[model samples]
Target chain A: MTPNLLVFRVLRNPKVTISLSLADWDLLLRQARCSNLLARIHSLLNEQGLIDRVPPKPREHLQWTHVIAERQIKAVHWEVTMIRKALAKVGPIILLKGAAYVMAKLPPAQGRLFSDIDIMVPKDNLNEVEAALMLHGWGTTHHDTYDQRYYRRWMHELPPMRHIKRSSVIDVHHAILPETAAIHPSPDKLRSSACSLDGYDDLKILAPADMVLHSAAHLFNESELDNGLRDLVDIDSLLRHFSNLPSFWVVLVERAKDLELTRALFYSLRYTTLILHTTIPPSTMVAIEIGRPNQLTLTIMDKLFTRALMPDHPSCSDWLTNTAKRVLYVRGNWLRMPPLLLARHLFHKAFISPKPE
Target chain B: MNISTLTLSELGHRLKKAGMFLQTGTFITHLKTSIPSVAEGIRLLYADYPLVEHLDFADFHVSLTYPRNLRRWLKPQIQFLFDGKPPFKPLPADQAFPMLEWGLNWCVSSHANHYLIIHAAVIEKGGYAAVLPAPPGSGKSTLCAALVNRGWRLLSDELALIHIGDGRIVPLPRPISLKNQSIDIIQSYEPDAVISRKISDTMKGTVAHMKPPANSIIRANETAHAGWVIFPKYQSSVPAQLKKLSRSRAFIRIADNAFNYSLLGIKGFETLTGLVDASQCYDFTYSSLENAIETFSALEPPASSK
Candidate 1:
C-alpha cells in the first residue's frame, strides 16, 4: 500500500493503535506534509484520543502544523470582515470553498489550510463588486494581456485580486464552472438558493447539497493535483458530516442530477470510497452509479485518478503517475474549452508566453 | 555508535543506498549523498555526533544528488530534496555541502514550529544562554564561533529553538558558518579550529563552516535558560560597545528576526514576550572578534564558573 493510504487507514481506525515505530511515523508525516493534510490528520488523531500513541517528536511537528492552520483560520476571518465592510453596498456576497467551509464551521474546515478567499456575486453585479473591492485596497494582479483577456471573456471568475497591504488573494466568481466549459451550471439558481450565514445578512453560503456538488466539480474539473488527495479528503469529510442528517444522501444525489453534475459526483463518490473508505449507503452508491462512464472509459479514469490522488511525493509516485497526470491535464483543458479555442490557447501558452526563469 | 566510528568509505557506501542517520540535539536527520565533498564535510564537522540506529526514525529524510537532466552533463548541478520533494532550485555541483547545511536549516526553521525558532546564534556560559539574533552578514556566526572556542557551550550557530512552555533554549550544536573576511578573522583567532574548504561565489559570498567544539557536541542535548538577547551589528572600524536595550524593543526585534513567529500566532507572541522578560537585552557593535568575544564574556556573572 502507498504511504498515503496507510495514513488514511490509521486515521480511519484509531483504536487499532499498536505501537507505531518512529520510522512508521516518519513515513506518515512525510506523506501528510506532501498532501497538505498534516493538520487534518493531526485533528483526526486527536479526536480519536490517539495522539499520545504518536512519538514526541512527530507529535510536536503535528501540533506545530495545527498551530499554523489555526493562525490561517484567524487570517481568513479577518479577511472576511474586511470584505464584508468593503462590499456592504454591493449586496449579498456568497462565500465559496475553503472560506465558506470555515465561515460556516463545517467538519471539513477543522485544521484545513486555506489558500485564498473565494466569493461569488451575481453575474450582473461583477463589475460593481470588483470596483468596490478595488476602492477598498484590492487590486487586480498583473497578468499578461492574453491571460487577462482569457479570464475576462471566457472564465467564470475575474482576474484574481490581492489586497495591496495584506497581499491576500480573493477570487471573485460569478459561477462555479467556467462559461467555456461543456456543462453549464445556472448561476442564478445557485445565487437564489444560497443560504444566509448566521448573524450576517449580507454573507451567504452554498446550500448543503450545492456545497458538496461544488467540491466534487472542483476536484474532477481542476488541472492541478498537488493537493488532489487533500481535496478528496475534504469531500469525504463533507459527505460523512452531512450524511448524519436524514435525507442528506437523497437530496445530494437529486441535486447532482438537477445541476447536471452527476459525472463529477460519480467520480467523487468512486474515489472517496475506493481510496478514503468513506461510508455511503449501498443504495446511494447504486443510485450515483447511473452516471458512471463505460467500461473502457472507467478503466482509463481509474488508472489516472488512482495515481493522481496519491500525494505528489516521489516515494508515493512511479513512472505511470506523472504520465497519467499529464494525460489528465490535457483532458481537463479539453473539457473546459472547445477543440479550436483549446488549440489556440495551448499554442499561445506554449510558444507566445515567456517561460518562467 | 557515533559517526566517527564509521570509515569514510563505509559512510559513503551507506549514504549511496540506505542513508546515514545522524543526530543533532533536537532532530535526527537521514542524509544521503554520493558527493565525496559532502561526506567529507559531515565527517569533519559531525565526527562527534551520534549515529541514529537503523530502526529509529529521522525527523528529516534528505538527499543531495546530481540532477538527472542534460544540465548534469552540460554544467553539473546538485539539488536538495526533503523526503523526496525539492524545496529549493538546483545549485552548482561544488555547492553540495553548503546546500546540505542550508537545506537542513530550512527543514528545521520551516517544519519545527513546536519551538519558537529565531534566526540567531546561541551560546551558553555559566548556565546563562546568550541569544544573538541577527540578519545575514551581521557577523553573528563569527562571534558565535569565537565564543564557542573560548569556553562557551555552543547551543546553536544559526537557529535558536526556544521551547515555548519552559522558556529554555534547546541546544542544536551544528557547524558554525563563517563567510568572506570573517573566515580569515576566525582562522587567525583560533589556529587549531578545523574549517572546511571554502566555496566561493555563493549567495553569501565565500563560505566555510567551523567544526563545533567537542565539548559542545558532547552536551548537545542540554537546554539552557534564556538570559541575554543581544542584537550584534558588525561595523567596520567601530570600537566594541554594548548598549542596553529595553524589553519591549528587544521583543519586537527578536520577533522580526524569528522564522515562524507570526506563523505560531499567540503562542509565538507569548513565548517571545516571556523570553524577552527573562533575559537582559542589548545591542552590541564591534569590528574585532577578540573585542566582541571579550564583551560577551563580561556579560556573564563572575560568581558562576564552569
Candidate 2:
C-alpha cells in the first residue's frame, strides 16, 4: 500500500478516523473530494456513528457531500421512474450500475453519486425503446456522423440521450460489453435471469451473481481511472452483501466462467481482498485461481492496478502513477476492440475530428 | 495576522510557493499565484482580511496560473484551478484578479451545500440584512456598493448564504465587484475608497473591485436576520420606487435566483420560504444610487426577528 494514503486507510478501517488529528483530516477530506468519495466517506462514518467525533470544519464537508449525494439519489429515483414509463410498452427495463444499486437497495447505494442512468433492453427492442424515449423529451446528444456510426455499429450502448428540458442523461444498452470485445456475454442470458424490482412489474435488476460479475467486468475494463477507486468500492460492497445468500460464491464462479468474465472476476476478487481487506471463502479463492494471469503478468498487473486504483490525488500518487494510468488507458482501448478498428478510431479522434465541445 | 502586514515582495513570494490562507467571511481559501495582479489585488483589496495560519484547513485550495501552452506566450492567458483541476476556461492575463474572484464564488456556490446559497447580494444594518436578488445588469452590485459606503455592512455582493438550520444570513463580505460605468461612479462617489486597477474588454465589459470596509471584515463572525428581500432593477429616468411584493412571489423568485435551490430539495424550499415569511419583500427600481441608498437606509428590522 502506498504510504500516507489517508483515504485508503480510512476505507480499510473507518474506525481509524476516530484517532486522526485535524491535520490528518485536512488531507483526508481533500483526497476524498479528489477521488469523488467524499459522500462515501460520509456514509461510512455515519454507519459507524463516528460523525460527531470528526472535527467541525471537516465534518461540514462530509455533511455537504451527503446533501448532494442525497439529492442525486432522489433525482435518480425520479429519473428511473420516468424511464420506466417511457419504455413501459417496449420490454423489461434492467437497471445497471448506480441506478441498479439504488433500486435494489444495495449496500453501495447509501451515498453513491453518478451522472448517468444505465439500462439494458433486449437487442430486438432497441429501436422501439429509442423511439419511445425520444417521444418523451429525451434526444440523442451526439451529432457527428462518424461518431454516431461508431456507436450504432460497434458499441454496446447507443449514443447517450439527454432530456431536452431537464438535461438528465441516460445510456441505453443492448449488451454488457461491446460486440467487438473478446468476452461475449449473451444479453438474452442476462435478461432471462434478471429479478423484478419490488414495486414495479416492468423494472428489473441483474441477478445477484450476474450483478457482481457485471460490476467486475465494467471496472476492470475501463480506461479512465478517475473513478477507479469508487467503482472498486462498489464491487467490494456488492461482494460483501451478496456473500450472505446461499451458494452465492459457487454461482458467481460458474457464471463468470460461463460468461467469459473470469479474468475481470479474478482481478476484482484479488484487489478487493488486497486493498479493502474483503474476505473471500478459501474454496472460492481456489476456484477463481483458474482466471489468474501468469506470474510475470500478475506481478506487472499488481504494480499497475494497485497504483491506478488509488485515489487520483497527489497524496495517493507516486512517480510511476501517470505511466501506469497511461498504460492502462491504452490497454482498456486495446481490450475493447480489434487492433485495426482501435487504430482507426484513435487516428480519427486525434487528427480528423474537432474536439468535443 | 492580516494581508496588510505582508510587504508586496513577501506576499508575492508566499503566493509563488506555498500559498497563503486568506479568510473571507465564513471560508478560508488557500490561494496561490505568480501573477502580480492577483497578488497585488489581494495586497490592495484584501489587506484587512485575516490570514489563517498554515496548520488550519482551508475550505478551498485555488490558484491562478498561466496555462502551459503556446497560448501562454501568444496572447497570454490565466486559468483558475480549484485543487488541481481547472473549472473554467482561461481568460486574458490582465483579467487574472477578476477570474480569481469569480472562481472563488464558483467554489462557494458549487460546494457549500451546508447553507442555502442564493445568487443575491446581502447587506446588513443594525442586525437586519436585506437580500438583493437580481440577474446581471440589474444594478444589484452597484446599489450594494453604494449602500455599503453609506453605512450598511456588506454581507456579500454575489452570494447570500442563508443558514439552513436558523434562517440567519451568514456574512461573506469580499471586495465589491463593479462593472463599466459603476466603476467610475463608485470612484467619484467615494474618492478615498480603495479600488483595484480596471481591466477592460472582458466578458462583463470593464471590471474593477472596491475594497470591503475593514469594520465588516472584523465582524466576520456576526450573523444577521433577514429584514427584506428586495429585487432591484436599474431603469433609466425612473423614480426610486419601492413596491411591496407578495411573499409567495418573493419565495419563488428567490428560489429561481438561487444556485442550488432545487438541489437542496425540501430543505431549500423550507429555508427560502421561512426567510420570506420573516422579511418584507419588495421590488425596487431606481436610476440614481443616491436615491437608492436613501431608501434602503429607512428599512426597519422585522418585529418577529431576533
Candidate 3:
C-alpha cells in the first residue's frame, strides 16, 4: 500500500509533523478534517509535546478542532446522564462505542467527537426502553414505512431516536449485529459479562475483552467508511489500553472464538497493525491466524480495506480507490442479511426513500 | 501583487488553470472558476486585494463550477466546491458571485473559531472601531457603506472577528452587500462607489456588492480596538438619534448576534466582556444617511475613568 498521504504518515508517527512545512500542514489539516480525525491528530500531537512546533496557521485549525472536541466531551457526559435518567426503570444499560469510552474514561474517549449516544439494553426490554425514551422527549427520526419495518424486523437496533428539544440522537440496540447476520454473538453473553461503572449501579460498559471484539465486529461489518479510520483508531486504542491487564490477549482471543467473531478480530488486528502500526504480540498474531481467510481472499480483502480506510479526500485517492470503497460498501450490506432481503433493502433505499445525509 | 495588476483575460486564464490565491485580511482563499461572470465580479470588486503566491498555504481551497450533468444546459446552475466537497446545494448560474461571497462567509463562521466571530458590520475612524450588530433589513450595510465612503475604514460588512486574547477587531474588508433599495441608495449616495451588477431573486432579495475603499483593503492587517457597540435601527422618517445603552444589555445583545459565542463557551464570554467593557454601547436610530453620518462622526470616546 502507498503510505504517502501526509495525514496517515503523521498519524503513524506524530513527531514527523514537527518538520512539515506550511504547504504540508495545509494538506494535513484538510485530510484530517475530511477523515473526521482532526481532533485525534491534535490530541496525538499534544501527547508527544509536538503541538508547540506546528506552524501558527495549522495550529489554529488544530486549536479549533480541539475546542470542538472539548465541547463534545462535556455534551456527551450531559447526554449520557439524561439518557440514563430517561431509561432509569427499563433495565441495565450498557453504554457502547463512543459513549462507553467516555463514561468508562477510556483512552479513546479523549478528543473524540461522536454525534449519537449509543446504549445497549436487554433484548427483552427493548420495547419498554424505547417507549420510556419516547416519553422523555426522544422520537424516531425515520418516517419511511419501509425503513421502519426493515429496522424493526431485521435489524439489531430500533430506528434511531432523537430528542425533541436538544436534537441529540440516541441509538438503542439489543445486540451488536443484525438478527439476520451470519454470526450471532449472544447479546445475553455480552450483557452477562458487562462491568458496572463506579458509583453507578445500573450503568455498565462491556467487559474489557467484549469491548474489543464489539469494536472489531462493528468496524468490519459497518458500511459507513466516513468514520472507518476513526473506528480503527478506537480499536488500536482499546488494545493498547487493554493489553496492560494480565492475560488480556488470551481472554480476547478466547472470547472472539466463543462469540463466533474471530474473523472480525482477524481483520481488526491485521488492518490496525498495517494502517495505524498498532502493536500486537507474535503469539497473539499466530493465535488469530485461525480466523484468517484463504490466501486469494485475503489478498483481495486487503486491497479493498486498505483503499477504503484512507482519508476521504481526493489527495489520498487513486483511480481504483473509489471502486474499492463501492465493493466494500456492498460487502458490508451482504454480511448483514440474506440475499433477497439485502436486495429489497438496497432497492428501497435507492428509489423508494428520500435520501438521508 | 494586487488582482488589479492582472489583465482580465490573464486573470481568467490563471483562475481557470491553477486558481488565484487571493488574500483578504488574515485569510487567503484559492479561488477557481470558469464562469466569466464570477471572474468579472472578482475583477471589479476585488481589484485592491493582494494576491498570494500559488504555492502558499491558503485557508480555503474553493471552486465555482457548472454542475456536470444535464442541469448545465437544462436550467443552468453553479456549485461552490470547498475542498472538493459541496457544502451547499447548487444555485442559479447568475448567482455564482453571491454564492462565492456566501460560501466564503460560511468557511469563516463555521471554522474560524480561533476568534470570537460576530455577525456584525464594523468600521474604523481614527484609531477606534464601531461594531454595528443588527438583523437583516436593519439597514446596517447601508449605514456601513455610507460611513466607509465618508472616510471611515471598512473592517468588515458581515463578520466581526475579535481577537480572543486581546479583544482587538481584525479588519476583513471585502465587498459591502446591499439589498433592494439600499443598493440604489448607496449608488446615489456615493456616485463614485463601484457597485457590482445587481443579481435578483437570491435567497436574499436583489443584492449588489459595493466595492470596499482601496485604503481599507491596503490597511487590512491594521487591527483596531473597538470603541463603540452601536445597534443601528433604520426606522423610516425618524430623526437621527443616539441613546445610551447599558454595557450589560449590550453584552447580551451582542452575544446574541455572534456566530460562535456559544461554541467558544467561556473564552467567548470573556472576550466579549472585554469588548463590552472597553466600548461605549449605544442604540442609534436614523433614516437619512446624511444625518446618520453626522451623528456617528460627532461621537466621542468614553472617559477613561469609567
Query: Judged by DockQ, which candidate is best?
Result: 2
TM-score for each candidate, following the candidate numbering: 0.97, 0.98, 0.98
lDDT of 1 by residue, B210-236 (tens): 999989988988898888899999999
1 or 3: which has the higher DockQ?
A: 3
* lDDT measured at residue A308 in model 3 versus the true structure, 0 to 100: 89
Q: Write the per-residue lDDT of candidate 3 for residues A1-357, one digit (tens) a residue.
A: 746778878878998997888988889989999888999998998988999998888898899889899889889989988988987887679999999899888989877889899899888888899999999999999898988998899999999999999999999999999998988999999999999998788799999999999999998998768798889989999999999999999999999999999999999999989988889999999999999999999999999998889988888888989999899888989999989988888898889898877
Clashes of 1: 0
- Per-residue error (Å), model 3, residue A293: 1.3
The candidate, 1 or 3, that scores higher on TM-score is 3
Which of the predicted structures, 1 or 2, would earn the higher TM-score when compared with the native? 2
Q: After superposition, how far is residue B121 of candidate 1 from its true place, in Å?
A: 0.6
Root-mean-square deviation (CA) per prediction = 2.0, 1.4, 1.5
Q: What is the lDDT of residue B84 in candidate 2?
A: 80
Model 3's DockQ score: 0.75
Tell me the docking grade of candidate 1: medium
Give candidate 1's whole-model lDDT: 0.88
